[model samples]
Target: MFQLLIVDDEASVVDSLADTLPWHEIGISTVFKAYSGSEALELLKTNTIDIMMTDIRMPGLNGLELLALVRREWKRIKCILLSGHAEFSYAQQAIQHDAHEYLLKPISDGEVLDKVGNLVGILQRERDESRHYERVEKAFQEHLPKLQGDLLADLLQGVKISPERLGQKLESLKIAIPAEGRFALMLFRLEDRFAELDFYSLSLMEYAVVNMAEELFEDDFRLWSCKDLHGYLVFLVTIAGEGDTQQDRQEHPDRAAEPVESRLQSMASQLQLSVDRFLKGSVSVLISRWGSFPLDIKRLYEDILLSMRKQVGNQSGLLIYASDELEQLPVHALQRLYEPPMLVHLLESGDWEKTHDKLTGIWSELGAKWADSQEHLLEAFFSIYASFSSFAHKNGRQLTDMIGPHLSDVTGLTPSRSLEALQQWMFQSLELLQQCMENETRNDRENTVRRIKLFVQKHLVEDVSLQAIADYMYMHPVHVSRIFKLETGENLSDFVLRLKMEQAAFLLADPSLKNYEVALQLGYQNPNYFIKVFKKYYSLTPQEFRQKLEAVEEQ
Candidate 1:
């Protein structure tokens, strides 16, 4: 809340001004009054005032003196001086001391209100900009620490986060959970509508979505949301009371599962329809089965993410992760099918022996952990997808692209046939992913060289700044400077100067051009400055250099 102060020696004028304006509606918390500048100074010392209104003709320590003091003490406070046009000199003095505006006396409450409203709007905008900057600065500060946390780690590893930090961040986000409960995850994502809602508005909408989801669950259950770090609303619901009881089944089990499931399913369907209808947006949702909890939240999150692999590019509907819904497969056998990036990284830099060692180490670790016909096969698949999906996504391919459409066509005999089909599918997917990774790596290297050459060549004739190069490449100027030094073994400024000097040498040899014309062509406004640079480069002034070249040509 912003405080507003009104100062006038006339009791009637001060009283009317203070009472007439609806302070709270205009976002002012308190209105202070002072008959003299002495009284106003006392009020200012004790209170936080955002705006001050004073009449220049106050009996003692008048508006001009108060404005001076305000500039010295409360320099941040905006001042509006009240004086008649006849006392225009006092208004002029007030402006010199940083008075916000000089208003004519006997002003109506309507005029007073309008000025105050405009001031408040300006103040509000300034405060909001500060807050947004604070958020961005805070995010950067916490980025590394948060990267060590479960969410990013799991997303990168294609596995779940550790249990502790999952609960911590969830609680911090104001999502409630019951002890020793079961949970199901539902991912609600708005496609291409991220920029439509700003941060604060999106935060509120996510809270509203969570509250609506909580309503569908019983009183025992509590729902919490972990926002999509990549982009979506991830909801975790803790099923209260006992487990999915037989009593629940006896009381029409399908209907029991049906209500909460159906509502979420309906939300998924209706949300997409509504987004398209109202916001020109689209949505997709992926739901998880009632996974046992006090159970790992990270695993549950991973399951939801894996369900998205099945979603592909579709806009609407819900996919539930269930034991029955999962095709029985040899996920454990396939787990060894793809080596993670650690081994891949060793391969990337042409560290052939280290790559071989890392590959062997990964297989050795997997050989002991993965056994034939592992019971929690789908859970293993979830972990694998969770680890790699984010990598695929960050580099531009969705999980669906990695897995391929063959995933949809396969279904067969109980465990073996399903396992072999899935095994082949996952292997094929990994192969496609490996190729994608290789292509991206090569492209990045090629692009880096291309961007550097383009940046240098584009600014060849001009005295290009590091900032200009960085802007052209869409990167930090310091980073561009550092990269230029690293790749070319010369500072950016030095490189550009050398290139320009070499070009200038060629231009100086052209007898048709005058020194100033050559300077202009070489991007120097001052010909004398160009001569100095030319002297530094060739150890001769432009005239001396041209004389030598002419002597050599004549000889």
Candidate 2:
């Protein structure tokens, strides 16, 4: 439905049109009558007028002038001019002012309905097109992150694409990095503290890290990031523009004095500190040297991975930069041992089969490449030992509890003495650890649910929010919600409401305590709202419920 405004200098003409015309039949739900052009303008300002029919020879602000002003302000409104004369000059002025129809003052109601109906059809078509475009835009925005991530991941993995296709993809994905721009790579590995998180929590932490990077680097660089195949977050960064750099220099004199590499190093250090302080986790950062984009991306990724494996060691929160002058490690640095889906991550995820395969692959590589290198054997031994020990401690146990005293007691070089002995110990320890974890999974969930219930009951009148419960349990709120729902077959929020309502019913049984007093006891600030909730829960108002109780007791 649309709105229509009828204007004329004569009051009778405006009233006749507004009252006698079947405007509703032509989809005009509202017909506004005005005696002068100025009154029509006032109506247009206050209401959304879709079609305007005005007399051409009004006293002030004539029809053509009004049409011109409406054209400037509300371009979508369709205007029709009414005149007593059929002069060509009047028609020419109507056409010049973009009027939809130039009708004589004694025009028929049928003609008016026909013209207004046509304008309504045009408006409906435009509205449909606009809604369709809005939906498409919304869907594209929702999937834009995944689209950008897929393109970046493909480029980093060296998928073959012509420059034209790559450029098209970049433009469509709205990536600001130039196709041939000079860029550098930054690789991040979440340390042991992050690795202990469940898969969902870990993904959220990775997202947080990326968001932090965007904030810290957005001033000087365009950053594109994705989680690579090796379970590491990779950021492809390029300088935004020379203007931005100059502006940054003028804004921060202290930072401007340092070289680009030094500034980046400082920012990376800040990122590490932020993660540790806010997220309660540590991350190891590796920044690669600058190289040409597209051509050097794959090489830089590989170099950074190699550097991380050789230099990161078992340390937590170490930041290293790739430099040409850095010392090269030994030729055989145990590639498969530090490869994607590392043993620790697999164990943390409880993928025992993959963990077993990972161990076998590491031993196979050790035998093929560095059979006689005792240092390599010990390196593998300690790495595997630390992963197992960390997993045990994470579950509130010790390595000795899972693998028995014999293996735990062997201090120095005993376990890594031979390939056969190390393999035996590794397999045996993996079997025992898998058994322990499987047995403990159910018990762990049950215990977590029990603790959550106790905490909610204790703080039933206090904050009992999800975050408060998670803090008390030393868990993420999402993790806590998931665990409670999985074990109890009910949402935590529903459970809390059920408890509150049940307690409200119990308190309502006491006549000495008023409804407001009971609401306060249950942490509800509004007694009326409490009554509404009680009625919703028990199918009766509190007063009625008390009456029923009294009747039952008298009976």
Candidate 3:
């Protein structure tokens, strides 16, 4: 809804304009009138006006004065001036005042409506843009935490993060942690008491644990936490700085690192206590020793994870704290498996080009970095193989149907399976699956277009609109139009029109049929409109076309 003000000195002029003009059609929900500039100013103050149309000359304060005041007070309200005097000076003043338009007196209703209609369009566009921005801003705010958590997950999973990139993401996500600092990894696992909880209940437990961890550690550490793919609650806790600068840290590295490790161990013990007391769930905590942020965090995760797995063997409510020992964790660079341009995302989107590129990058990275680790190679193979299997299942097909029974025995493959054998198997499987998907899509499209063509042929003398065809096919008009053009190389409307013209030509060749009868038979009620369309298509009137056809037949 929008408000407009019509200000003129003459009451009759204002009344006639308001009463006759279709204000609602132009999206002006309310029209306010004023016989004087003072009254207009008072109305402007009282209402939220979107546009103001004012006479240039009025009693007491004039239109130009009112325009200036409105521009100052209500900057968003658009203004237009009206006057009998079409003087250059007055137009210049109107332009200077930022009046949207200046129309002379005795303006036609069409001109006024056109000007106001254009302004209404502008207002609607402005409102839409504002709403779009606000929605985007709100969505970003809502997802800020998830985004920050994802970044942390990427870094902890050995995805390379440059210093500048890290700083930019930290700032964008509004995380207070410094990009270059001492940090540690913590892995928490809920014990057997809550192991029987459903997915939703487990999610609630994870949230409660994270909230409690934040409350306990936020004072001393900039904490980021998320449930990793392996179902462990992982935290990349950056140690807050002491009252010392980088140079001071260079002079006393142990002083900055050792105290934080001790404090984190104490905090982890207390976190376990809080979980047991309030949450009624016991959690085992694995705390890594302090390491440099981002660069050391991934290695720290690998080391602590391995340690926890080895030491905590079937134990619960235990704290497996890391020592000062730094193990050289192998660089898998397998983090690309979980990141963007990933095989799953590409496969889900059915983007063959990007999917091919992603598969190539994965194999290339494996050959360059993890070729020696047969275990890592097997892991990558299974990950991609599982994705393809899932893709096949979703399409109501089987991997064996696409590539034979060898792929179904993927779990039986050992680390001893040669890399070349695995790569060949994967490439062949993928190519076959891609071809199948493409064939299925093409067949589906051809079938839809075939149905639509039949529908149009049957309804040529009826309503052959795109929407009508879509309704018959039980599809959306946009989908019907797009696939029709893609499959037939012609617009849906053009196809319908061509069919109608063919029917018209057939009917016109019958000497017994009158022009109006032919028009009505082909679903055109107006003979003139039918003749005009026929001329546009055939370069002759219907009568001329019939005479030419008869002469040709006689010859």
Candidate 4:
């Protein structure tokens, strides 16, 4: 309900206007009457007003003074000025003071009510719009976490954001967590990739990691995960917990290193089941040395990443390692080893014989570097396939589909403990890959032809129909027509007409298809109109055409 106040020097005038106006019908349910601006100011102190009416010529404090006070203290309250004298000076003051309405001498109830009703509509619209804006803001705030998570995930993929712009966006997104004096970090690794190796494939596991990290931390932490430098998913966990050593003590003052180790083991045991249920993948955790916040976070994350590269000796998903376990495997080292004789050089020089022999040597070299099972053999495959996949996809083909089928089919050619077999597998895979490339190119052409056929069928009945099918497909109609005619060895319109006639001939023989049904089935909107076209094409009305076909069949 809108509260309204009426102020005039004459007590009877203020009361009469307030009582006579039927303000309730005009959306003002509560009313206050004041004989002067001073009295109205007092009333305003105790009451909230949506609209006000005052005499422009009130004694001592007039409507203009009251309007000024309202502007200062209650800017939302709308004002209307009343006056007995019809003076230009009074009207000028009302206009300057932002009075919503002005009426002279003995105002009728209906006129006042109409003016108030107009103001009420304006007030309601303003309120509704304000409410809508507030709701939209609240919803954006509520979903900030999920939005921030998605954004952080994209950022960690090495999607570029300049440093200054990065800081501004971080602030705006509310992920710029208070970097207190100290920070703690943890890197999580998903251990197994051979089960199904794919970057897009592990979206479920990444979601699980974010959820689990939230539950384990006390301090609010912003998280982002990426395939680490070692090719394992390293969760860069940065926490603004106090100095690590002090914070660890605060967490459990009585526990020694031995008990802490036991607790970590227990935490790992519980976490393994949860991770296994969701990921169907292996995992490992590397906790960073406690240090300062944000500044120390990147370095700590790198430590955890380095730890992921040093795979544990067992197949278990959970592995624990400190910085000591890390063995740097930067590409610069490989560049030094192959500067004079790079793999690309050997391959591009048409040294198939040399490249084949190099593969045999690398197989044993990798085996010696890690006397583990053939699991590490996959690391080489992943590296080679990654580069090859990029090259293939750039050339509009995928190498994985080519290599995967052959690997699945020919188990006899599989490499065991031998380098020669590995080379033979690589060479054989490439040969199969060539066939896949040809098939892919052929299939692309076939798909284009099929699409063109479908397009022609959809638009054949329309009068202004050249390239209508391609227009619907958002392609150049002429391009579609040219390609379609090239592939089918006929004009696009001829193909469309032939297809329409085939349907027409079928309808002519089928006794069940009514005339209107035949028209609709062949894409005509009007059955009578369709008959004219049918008669033109076949030299008979639709009914006559069908009857003639029947007569011929009977003969």
Point to the candidate with the largest TM-score.
Answer: 3
Which pairs clash in the backbone of model 2?
Answer: none
lDDT of 4 by residue, 1-555 (tens): 688888887644654566445677778888776766876886688678888988888778878888888888887788888888889988897788788888887777778888878888888888878776887789989987666655544443333456677677668777644444444445565666634656666666666666775565433333444454344544444433323477666785544434434444455455667777766656766665655544555445555655555554444565564563333543211211122343445544545566555555555566456335455555555444454455456666555566675553434435533445555666676556556665875686578878767766665554324324655656555566667676778866567656876788787688998988888877767675567566656778878888788888899
Measured by C-alpha RMSD in angstroms, how accurate is candidate 3?
Answer: 13.6
Report the Cα lDDT for candidate 4: 0.62
- Model 3 agreement with the true structure over 139-245: per-residue lDDT tens digits: 99999878988987777766666789889988988876654576778999898877889999998989899999999887677688877767899988876555558
lDDT of 2 by residue, 17-49 (tens): 675567788788988767667667766886798
| TM of each candidate vs. truth | 0.34, 0.37, 0.64, 0.32
What digit string (tens of lDDT, one per residue) describes model 1 on residues 257-332?
5566565565556545655675565566676776555454445565566567654445444344433223343352
Q: Tell how far residue 421 is off in model 3, in angstroms.
A: 3.7
Per-residue error for 301 in candidate 1, Å, reads 8.9
